[model samples]
Target: MASLPQALPEPRAAGPAERPAPPPVARVRRRRRPSGEPPPLPRQLRASGRWWLGLSALVLLACVAVVATGTIRYVDVADTRVLQAIAEIRSPALTAVAEVLGLLASDPVLHAIWLVDLVLLAVFRRWRHLMVWLGVGLLVINVGAAMATTLQRPRPFEVEVLGEWSGFAMPSLPVTVLAALLVSTLYSLVPPGRKRTVGKWVVCGLLVLTAASRLYLAQDHPTGVLAGVVLGVATPLAAFRLLTPNSVHPVRYTRARPAHLDVSGDRGAAIVRALRDQLGLVVTDVSPFGLAGSGGSTPLKITVKADDTVRADESCVFGKLYAATHVRSDRWYKLGRTLLYGRLEDEKPFQSVRRLVQYEDYILRLFSDGGLRVPQPLGIVEITPEREYLLVTEFIAGAREAGEAEIDDAVIDQGLGIVRRMWEIGMAHRDIKPANLLVRDGTLYLIDSAFAEVRPSPWRQAVDLANMMLVLALRTDAERVYRRARLHFSDEEIAEAFAATRGLTMPSQLRRMLRQQGRDLQDQFLALLPFRLPPVRIQRWTWRRAGLTVVALAAAAIAAYVSAGVLAAPL
Candidate 1:
């Protein structure tokens, strides 16, 4: 028999409720919690790290060696002699090529191009990639500047300089800047093997040409250019040590290991204590949920004893831990979500882990008040100050994803009720999909209310309905789901709500299922529309924004002018 709506009475939530202990399930794996830190990486990366450490140390030592050699040459050789020797090799063709190379690397045009690339990286939220280039670029340029003043090396053939120059001669920064640019650009961009190889060699060839041009034109002594090369190359290698993530190859959505629960670590212990004190349920055993993989929030089935011991019934409670900080990819994902439905969005994404718990808890209670079946919010656990939070709730046993189960009239009715409740309360479940809807004991339940928001716009409500309709369409037919929704919504209202599908984000899983069934949700929704709707405008034009844009453009133009004059200045 199904767990009928009348079978279980709706229990009202007053505060946190202590879960009664039940018998423990046999443990398949008993992973000791990590000492409140990420799992120690395997031997391969550590071994590679040891060798890499040696290589970078060697490079830094080489830098010191170059500085020493340049210092000796500066004292022994006069600038006039250096220029005379370089003059012997200079020709009209070589001089012109060298001047072009210097300008290409040092001119404001290069800076503008670099700025454009950086802006693109930022627009895509490629934080790590951006940091890598910026880190290495800054170190190379700053060190070159520092060395120029400290060494006070004289320039050879000063009259040959076409640009105004004020800095010391040793470590020709044009070489340093351009070399670092080439190396960092190569380091950041990894295309297919053949293309990447060709690109790398081309850039490297340009770097070689740059160095020869500098030497032939008597821009600086050979030693100065050599020192610049060493610094430029070493800075990026060193920056990699400091800036790269500890994990060399990061897999997406990897769950926090069982070590996360290792109470041996202070953070881990703090979390356990928080649960015991705040929630009033003493946890005995904890493990990852079989179905839970890497996601924004972590879901685990925790075994708890009422008396705070293993003696009581080992009741299994579903607990989810919202992390204080997301991995780089997760943060990027949040930004993408905002861009996906900017106008249709009802609320800002949860700002903090605690906020996520707060929002979801509030929604759960609100739905429960409306006699809707959802997981009961048990208690909140604070692991760290405003960073990590845990929400423990009653586990609905024998639950299957609505997509994975048969969607009968009962299921369709239950889904409609959820939509109606949202309408009544002026709230929207921004993400209502087959995965978020679960059926247990013939009763329907909603999960993952993290994206739910209150006083939602009509479009948001329509989105909720459309998504729910799509979810039901998976088990049944898209037309069938639409027909059932017609009972609640008029044809025009349904079309308008589905018009929200202009930029709809159907979960990847649903898309895959739809593919298997030869039904495209996007196409189906489009066919329903009588006419094509114009694209949603994400950015609005405003006077102040326009002025800011104009001001920024003017500033950039002025900076380019200054940089061009600076590049042409001769020392």
Candidate 2:
């Protein structure tokens, strides 16, 4: 009567395969020009980023309304008769190399290389590239020196004026403050793709060679070097829409991630075509498991095979590839620790990536249909679009970690029948710790039930029995794991699972179990688990959070009238 191993299906990633290839060798040795309609430059460069931030904020409010309008005095006497006919057709070999390229792009040698790049971005603390060069060099050098001292406008050629400068030009603060500090220091020291497009055309060719050496040394006139390179490219595009990062994160306060490396090469062959197009598992090979952590989603590890349609005892499996394109800054790190504590994680409540690979393939087919032990998932892949996914399972062949085995009593009676069949089918794993428990051959599998759940939670089943009884009392102890967790919890449900670690939600797996079980196992788990804090009413909703209690009683009545106007301001 043998008939079970089926469970694969899931699907959904569907994008790259409506079959379209064979076009390149210069589009078939260049001939068919009679329009076939395939390449509208990738649909007119899929524009979005707020249409290039509203076309660089309408060309920086039309170059700060043409340098405070005298609208370049209708081409100021035709740009002072084309800079006195190019400063009388200069030729002492091009006016001594335009007076040494206007004293090597001067303004005190680019303000001593912008004060040694703001003292090495304050000795490398980078505060967002020193707040985009102190908010785009204090609004492009004090609004182009108060719009060149209230449009005083004067300079052009009192003699063969070759170098030295003065002021009152209306705009030319070194071609709008060195093209907005060399395009925000080549967009904060060249980063985004192709070395920030060759550092934006080498800061627009050294801001057009310092605006053609301030108009070949005739100095301020070509409408003040075209209104100081249009207020230095609109003050670093309005300091990138006012210091962007409202949310980026991908977790980078460093450390952790070293479980060997390669952190996914060739995105592990696009996660073996997302396990043969979303979990059918046709992959042949790909490996490297565990240690992905540091965020910006890069979990990988494979060892597939599957092929000959499944059964060689459901062919070799072992894979983990989450790839949410390497989840940066802890993708809203567990919804900001469940919006600052309370109602913790249970996977999907949506934070997309196909709702975390459809909530870890519905928590490994709800722990392989209730009989507990896990892994088995074997499929679900979306290798990109709403940013990547992959979740093949079945990798248990002789497992290991519950902190490298040996807590004894047959791994404490198969982690007490996987925590009493997850509290008799009213589930809740809420990450049980000891690297998601394993111990293979001698049973107890439960590997990452991607924050398992089912409902009727008693403080998430007392955080999966006080994180598997303080991860088996750190590999043995606390009275032999509280005498095998009092044969399934008693002393007041182990003091409400050690008083639900005083309202946990300090997430990263309860801050790595209070930095490896400290606070002397919280008074030896508050003298053997099970707590009591029943109290009563605190319903201050006032019609469902009346505008957050009138903005917290108008910020505590303006902080008690500014602390009684600083104690009636007399001192």
Model 2 root-mean-square deviation: 20.1
How well does candidate 1 score on lDDT at residue 20? 36
RMSD of each: 10.4, 20.1
Worst 10 residues of 1 by lDDT: 7-16
Q: Write the per-residue lDDT of candidate 1 for residues 1-571, one digit (tens) a residue.
A: 1121232221222112344333443322233335654422221234444554465466446546656776545433655576667677777887777788767556575575566657765665545666677767666667787777766766765436533345677678777777677766555554324664797678768878777776666666676776676666656645543354222212122344421332333434554566666656666766666343225566777776543443443367787766544433344455454444343332344556666788778887876665566787776776654655778787776788887888876677678767866787677777776777888766778787776777877767877777787888787876676656656555665676666654345565566667788778656765764554444343434454456457767976985675455345332
Rate residue 43 of model 2 by lDDT: 15
User: Evaluated with TM-score, which candidate comes out highest?
Assistant: 1
What lDDT is obtained when candidate 2 is compared to the true structure?
Answer: 0.58
Residue-wise lDDT of candidate 2 within 153-230, one digit each (tens)? Answer: 778644466777776766777667667767666655544557767777877777777678768778778767776776
Query: Per model, how many backbone clashes are there?
Result: 17, 25
What's model 1's lDDT at 412? 78
Worst 10 residues of 2 by lDDT: 21-30
